[model samples]
Target: MRKVLKADSLFFYFFISLLWMEVIFRVSVMKQSYSFGILISCIFVLSLAFLFFFLCSFFKRKAGFFLSIFLLGLSSFIYASQFIYFKFFRTYYSLYSVSNGGQIVEFWRDIAAFAGKHSILLFLFFAPVLFLIVFGKKMLVFKSCSTVNKLSLACCALFAHGTGIAAVYAGGKAPNSAYDLYFKNSYPQLSVERLGLLTTMRLDLQRLITGWSPDIELAAPRDSKYIPTPAPSDKAKEDPNERETSGKIVEYNTMDIDFTQLAANEKNHQLKEMHQYFEQVQPTAKNEYTGKYKGYNLILITAEGFSPYAIHKGVTPTLYKLVNSGFQFTNFYNPIWGVSTSDGEYVACTGLIPKNGVWSFKQSGKNYLPFVMGNQLQKLDYKTMAFHDHSYTYYGRNISHPNMGYIYKALGNGLDVKKTWPESDLEMMEKTIPEFIHNLPFHTYYMTVSGHMQYSFTGNYIAHKNKNLVQDLPYSEQAKAYIATQVELDRALKYLLDQLEEAGVADKTLIALSPDHYPYGLDMKTINELAGHTVEKNFELFKSTFILYTKGMKPTTVTKPISSLDIIPTISNLLGLEYDSRLLMGQDAFSNASPLVIFLNKSFITDKGKYNAVTNTFITNNGKTAADEYIKRMSAIVEGKFHYSAKILETDYYRKIFSGNQ
Candidate 1:
């Protein structure tokens, strides 16, 4: 009995240590500090140990060995399955639901890429730990067993199996609170169905080996597109033909849609009115500025969390110069997107609005993505490349970038940059510019991260040498800290411009600057305080600065409400690239399409007025009565945009568009 106790204790200690090591690895890589409630993890570790001990005591030696092998194999399989599911299939599953057929292939491809990239590290990290857990103590101890001992071991194994199965089933129904917290906070987009399946699968083997399952509901796939219709209690009794052909029917009570309750023909009339508004708003191309800087290098920088507020006379001279001396957009606005930062980038680069509730960039990986500047320039025999100073895999940029027809490079995977929480944008510029300038007629897209949010001193500190310049700004410590973060970003931009000038590509390279999103994490009070007034929370609050600069071109300011969505079409027009009008949801800001900025909450802004769909209020630059006709018109445009965005995601819209079939 004492020998058994000692062996179990050793096993528990080893397993707990391994778990802790994994925790430490996660913390170090994320650079996030531990706060309170670490003791809960300790308790969990102890609980696992207790269960391990009970199993070892009940099972015979040979039976226990087989049980351990089974557990290890099962866990490995589940982990591998998750990687495969996420990579090849864009859809994730819970224990309760399955992904669609299209998503299944996507999951497979993602796994292949991940495996190809990290197989060696995976084997190195897991193999030694697995070997130690299974075989470490075997070489040190040997014992012979009798019939009684063998029978006892078999009973223990059976008990372990029963407990594991129970645990998995229980866990599927109701996961541990701690696990739920971690899952929700870290991976918000993970479907409940996938979570349930994983919980069940993970616990089943553990419970069979240990003795229990966490009774939890297996998560099922959430049908975001499902619109429920009101039906009789006994829906099965109704004739199928009675249901509307345009609408899909679902079983769950939550899926019920009250289509009959929709406001009558007035809504349709309003939609048509909005479509008319778009037609009335004409944006003519400037024929006077028709000189084409053909075959010139073009550099587009989408700075992270960049805001118009960042532009100041003394603080950001270069930025101010670009804003004042170039073709600056005064009323330019960037509507906050549903997925926000990276998603906004997806819209700007693809010239398509992102669908709500999913990462468009990740979804775009499956279809052909057209890049007006990169792909079109490449066709013109231009060297095209895209650079990002962060993990390319975070938003699945690895897949999306390549699909954009650019030779993509990012930190850790393809490019070398300074190692920091958010890698230095300056370092990225220093390393990448040489590769880009060697040849003429190149187009490079850069996604910068130095201006990311969580605007406190610690969060925004830059590792560059020019950090001292921001100390004299007349602002609060927090505000100064926020500005300091952008200091590096500003410096990075200045450096790139200088390099272009030195290489004599400044005149040849057309530079465009736009923000991915407003710095939302910063205190609104601080922002308002800095601006010397209350910043409107509607569309204007979300407005961003846009700069289009060429060395000697006459600066022309346009007070148009253009969005990131217009970037591709606008650039295409500027570069004289021919594209089918039907290919993009956004029109050229300089073209005949009415310019509109869309917000995360489904509101929109245009030159005429700002419409808040939630409040049903229309506010114009000059205080005027609500224009019912204008409101209806804008609503239809927004609705059409939503419909198209969804269609693009569900169907292969880009493929059809690029192939000239749509």
Candidate 2:
């Protein structure tokens, strides 16, 4: 035992300390659910630590020790960073973000805020690196091994790693695909719980460097897009020539898709498969609410960090009016996708899940994003325009907005709003109104930034600008600061309403507003303070406001599970515009189609229940749960949506399906 201890005692001890600290941080601080699966993942992390140490063993003793300490420091930083980032942003970064180092620099204030609150945990994360550097070479003993023996041991480490991975595969119930392995099943928090920080970083680096990606095979929809035929057994199905059924008349809107014709004409096997798939998707039924706002102008806003908590009538009357009077969605969500606001905006704008890691909006710059609200309205000669108060090129919106059929503008572009550190939403509305307000039958999209992060009065200009309004609120400083920033948004909406009223389009213009995400800038404690209770982190944290109002349209309340991903198709349906429902990932909330909300981690919420994919557990709202086969079937469908959404971004599938769209 002594001999073996000396063999790799320093690395072994260091690794054990790092692993346990990470485990405690995750289980205790991050408040991740404790499970035996995470224990299995810790073992896998230990194997990785051993393999890394073995790989470095080939170097001279002192050199290897120093290098190992360096590796330790790097791993410490990554883990600590992940913890801090989650604390501040409630999202994890990919290795691709390492390439965007400047973006991280921009969040130094956020990092400082996290460190101020959680110093002890952060300190412990780096203690191993410090201890190893101080004593690893001089005080720690290492057993001597010949170069040949080191080589043999390294090979053994490789064999052990392979075996551990195979063990995870055979016993761990991990998702089958390599992509699903790291992404779908093991999200960052869960991945670290299961695969350790070192291993997670290793796979991330491997993925980023090798230009390798998960080859997700998109499942085709089972039924063709054509009208479903009655079963032969159901009254000896009359001639297949009868395409319409009297019992139910499904409305396809005006999306003139001849699936039969497209299938016959398409030469590409991939395109034909896509056509076949969409043909089977259930088209959203046109209810009495359909075309309720036909030919109405649109003012769509994706507000930064806005939430239901920010919608106080006293502080934000315009927002309050919109929420109470418009098409109110009682259970709308704005899930934080992996890429933050860009992806959040992507879901609302494109009605699709953003592909993980890559900026899906940027990739869609070349694709036919006809389902985009602007694009759909543009076909009718509505002057479509998009505005962002921040950098226009942020997230490649410069390319993407135009692809969505909008004449896009941002801070540096044609639209000029006073530039503050975070910019001002009120100024954005004031400046942008003139451009499109007079253009009757216009559809405008605005990505507001006044409600952006580092929610404090001192550092945040917008928050400070309205600090006096929130100072009296009985809330934490952080919570007050958040509301202060949103005060700017409130004023902006007020300004927008006045301008529309003056422009004679208040009632004729449909205003739809939603937060890009929850206020991740506010800590969970602050969120609870605001909510006056403990908000369930998994699902309730995502609860948000989706405002749709056209001056004084009849107030209709929609109580259904819906999300930002449902925005595009819903708007298209309300405006009676042409859209292929089968091609969209989300259904219109007002339509009879079942509501399904998907999270970045693949967890989901349906009307019946919630499924946290990380735990592989489902909890039905009622005691009567869905059948295993039903859940299994829904899971497959959800997986297919994710897979195909990614495929659409990568292969530009829409351009192929709708050749005339672009």
**lDDT per model vs. reference:** 0.58, 0.76
lDDT for each residue of candidate 2 in 1-662, tens digit (9 for 90 to 100): 88766776765775686676667567644455445446545666666676666657667676777677777887788878877766666667787766744266666876787687788888888888888777777766544457886777677667767765775565544343233565443255555555555667677787667654444445434432211221222221222112344775445443666666787898888667666666555566667777888999999999999998898888877788889998889999899887888888999899898776666777788888778888888889999999999887787888889999999999899878787869998888888889889988899999999888888878899889888898888888888889989889999999989999998999899999988889887877899999999998888999998998888788888899899988888888888876767778888888766678888767788767898776677899997866766566566667777766776787788777678756
TM-score of candidate 2 on Cα atoms, chains taken together: 0.90
| 1-662: candidate 1 lDDT, tens digit per residue | 97775544434543554344334433422233222223333333344434443454455666555555444444344444544443322223333222212323323433455578767544533553477466745631223345675455556545644553444344332112234323221121221122232333443334334432112221111121110112222332232112332375422101111222322222464333322322222222323332265566889888887887787778777788888888878777776564566577987787787764456677777886555567778888889999998877656788888777789999877789876755688889999989879777889999998876445555334623334666787777666666767777787888988998898888888888888877775667778866778998776677778888888888887777788877776777677665533446666666533567776555777656787754567888677875675566555555555555555565664463246531
Give the runs in model 1 whose Cα sits over 4 Å from its true position: 1-291, 463-467, 660-662
Residue-pair clashes, model 1: 50
As for candidate 2, its clashing pairs are 41-194, 221-277, 224-279, 225-279
RMSD of each: 14.9, 3.8
TM-score of each: 0.58, 0.90
Counting clashing residue pairs in each candidate, in order, gives: 50, 4
Worst 10-residue lDDT window for candidate 1 reads 220-229
